[model samples]
Target: MNPTPATSLSALREVLPQLAHPDGSPVRALVVDDEPMLADLVSMGLSLCGWEVRVAHAGRAAVEAARGFVPDVLVLDWMLPELDGIEVLAKVRSFRPGIPALMLTARDSVDDRIRGLAAGGDDYVTKPFSLEEVLIRLHRLVQRTGVMALDADELVVGDLSLNVRTREVSRGGEAIELTTTQFNLLQYLMENPRAVLSKAQILDHVWDYDFGGQANIVELYISYLRKRIDAGRVPMIHTVRGAGYVIRPA
Candidate 1:
């Protein structure tokens, strides 16, 4: 039997990990579909999963939204009026460049899929798709192109070095053993060194959107990180008092 909407939503939460702005804000998404009902449906579902969503009903409006929304992902319909999906994708690409896009359309043929992929759609879904399928595809797309898609294999902040390709972390040439969660959390901080990140921000980026744990969980992990990453070394992870946490040179 097909899953219920609530079941599908729960599956989506399992698939798409929470991604937050450095300040721990919800990850932004832009939905471009002339069909108001469909657009609103997607927006509402994603919003329930903690995404900050925006909608654009026209190709031009979609392109304009990309400029300011800076969406982490774009859900675009292929047969848009005025600009068509390909043209809108191309135009948005000039600005967003590597932003991931999922192309939606009634076109299910191989040729149509190829054209959409060539036009820079990261994923594609045919019309009459279930919301569950859309959410699953979206999760895979973000995993492929979002935070995990590093431009460089190695990340460096002061004496700290993280090899993205190797999943390795070291400080001052000494290897550091970190749990998978710790590793991901450290990578997030390393990516945005010197930025004071609040607990909400950390949870959003490092945990699942549906995470029900207390915010102090962030404090617990931060303490764990300090023990493994700092200990005797010159501390790089710092608390900003009323602010949050920052990773920078001592």
Candidate 2:
């Protein structure tokens, strides 16, 4: 049966911004999921980030792909036919012990999360997740591994610079002070650059996942950020009318 064209994942995908390896070398990724369409969607997203990606629908295939591809990062789904994600992760770890991995699971239990992490998963995401989340999490995971030898800590958008380690944000030649929450919101915005982020997305990322509050809190924080970072200068924080907020180069 053909899915409605407009409702398919392919149709939902927009022109994603590109993210690249710092060394100008090619970055490879392995996406393991039994769901063919989900795997394909994820592969597409990673490819858009200018990374080479391989998709494996089963656990054995995942391990073989890992051996041959030597991917910089792995996105593994917890459930699969034949061998499960944990089994695949264990087998892959045998050879690529230091390889960073992100686990995707439908289970939300604390035990499940701990098991995946104890099994060598460097990060975790639940199923029905956004492709953007996968891309960002995997990007962070790869950076943490130091295999890419990239300057993954510092970020710059035009004149605004953010140092993840120092927690310092600077505008042009001047330093800007920010609260922890404000800093996190700005960091997420800087990570995405020109892309518009919805309030819900911002809440999920900048705020805690279980942060049961309204979008007003995001707006309140954005205002605080604007006052501290953008006031009396070329504004970097912008509101997209009915959409959401974005931080562009000032």
Task: Using TM-score, give the best candidate's number.
Answer: 1
Weakest ten-residue segment in model 2 by summed lDDT: 1-10
- Candidate 1: misplaced stretches above 4 Å? 1-4, 148-250
- How many clashing pairs per prediction, in order? 1, 0
Ten contiguous residues minimizing lDDT sum, candidate 1: 142-151
Per-residue accuracy of model 1 over 66-176 as CA lDDT, tens digit each: 998888899999988889988988898897787789998888999999989987888898888888778767755654342332236666665677887899998878999
List per-prediction Cα lDDT, in the order shown: 0.80, 0.77
TM-score between model 2 and native = 0.53
- Using all chains and alpha carbons, the TM-scores for the candidates as numbered come to 0.59, 0.53
lDDT of 2 by residue, 1-250 (tens): 1232334434433432233443456678999988899888788767756679999999899999899988878889999998999899889989987778899878668899998899888888887677666766776566443323234677667567788999998876699988899899988887776678989899899876654667889999999999988899988889999999987655
Candidate that would win on lDDT = 1
Task: Tell me the deviation in Å of residue 134 in model 1.
Answer: 1.1
